[model samples]
Target: MKRWWIGTTAALMLIAAGCAGGTDAKSGTNRHDRHTSGQAMPAFVEQSTIPHVREAYAFAEANADQLQYIPCYCGCGSLGHESVKSCFIAGKKANGQLEYNVHGSGCEICVNVVMDAKKGIEAGKTLQEVRQQIEQKYGPQLSPTNTPAPPEGK
Candidate 1:
């Protein structure tokens, strides 16, 4: 059916958009197709073919500052990850470039946590609400990262 084909095509396009992409720090044309920010994706992320892995990595990098307040519940605490952000970002370099956490590129629990946070935010939840929701959802069965609660009052 034509409708089926169109729906399938749209889904494929969405999947393709979430794929790991190469970057060109110079030329504009024929550059990174998924994200044209001119910054290369970490090799670890680029090695993944899973759309969610790539999508979550991109989201984690772009929202690093905010994610610091969101806890990741996957026992990453034992790994010294202080917050959800630490699952994806090890730290910044002297020049301000993010040092990617290779663990992020492979961990489904980390990616799912980030994705859930994003969905909550997009659905009009406040940061506090989002944090609480994630905690309530995962706290019972998993160990959470050392992320602190959102700064008191806003």
Candidate 2:
């Protein structure tokens, strides 16, 4: 009987620890957090769609203000430097020329947003409309209030 009581107590403790996130493995953080310390993006993305990728990056850079209204895709709680810059470097030369080696850590998200924005632009969707589409698609994962503001003017 005493052994049974001891076993039950240990089991309960384990269950409680797991529920409270006291286990050896922690799962709250993700790639975006890892990037916040100011890391660089990758150097190769889908080759066939460079222009589309560049457009998306351009859109994000142009709409820094709108970042406050959207979220990032890296699973980071809020927008960080890496997420924002990834948009700019998704697919372009370091000198802003055509470059095939361009890559970005958050390129997938940036690419998707950029593609959507380009489609919107081609469809005569204003910048605001395109931004709205991006927010609608990626907002839930982004931290609207945490995004940093851009320069003072333009």
Candidate 3:
């Protein structure tokens, strides 16, 4: 819905003033604060007919903070992907709205990773444990993006 995108756009604008290296009040992390949320997805992803594509995009959008620390084992690093989250989001637009990456729409591995992480987290698996399992399972056979490991004890 255009209304939802407008709201999401407005929300991102509020945080646009926070520059890179600035501390984000909500997370207290020392990094560039880019907008992230389950606001609204791009039309293609929102209306995707492929099985699990829409669901995965929604999951990635909603759980970006957690997904950011998980790596994509689908060889998207060549495209400058740093983590699983990168498979769905390229970056933010100058208007502060997110720029959706089209890579995930056609990549089964990307969606599967997102869903696996989602189900695992929902089933009480910690991010670290989930990352470990994903790494062991996919790392051995697939190309990994530049995803960083989950923080210790998290």
Top lDDT model: 3
In model 1, which regions exceed 4 Å deviation? 1-30, 33-37, 49-51
Candidate 1 lowest-lDDT run of ten? 28-37
How large is the C-alpha RMSD of every model relative to the true structure?
A: 8.3, 16.5, 12.9
Model 2, position 83, has a per-residue lDDT of: 40
TM-score of 1: 0.74
Off by over 4 Å in 2: 1-43, 46-72, 75-86, 90-106, 144-154
Model 1, position 137: C-alpha lDDT score? 89
List, residue by residue over 1-154, the lDDT tens digit for candidate 1: 9999999999998877755443444643334433323456676787875558777777787777779999988788999988888988788789876677888777888888999998987898888998999988889999888787777663
lDDT of each model, Cα atoms only? 0.79, 0.46, 0.80
lDDT at 19 for candidate 1?
53
TM-scores of all candidate predictions against the true structure: 0.74, 0.37, 0.70
Clashes of each: 0, 3, 0
Lowest-sum lDDT 10-residue window in model 2: 33-42
Best by TM-score: 1
- Which TM-score value belongs to model 3? 0.70
**Clash list (residue pairs), candidate 3:** none
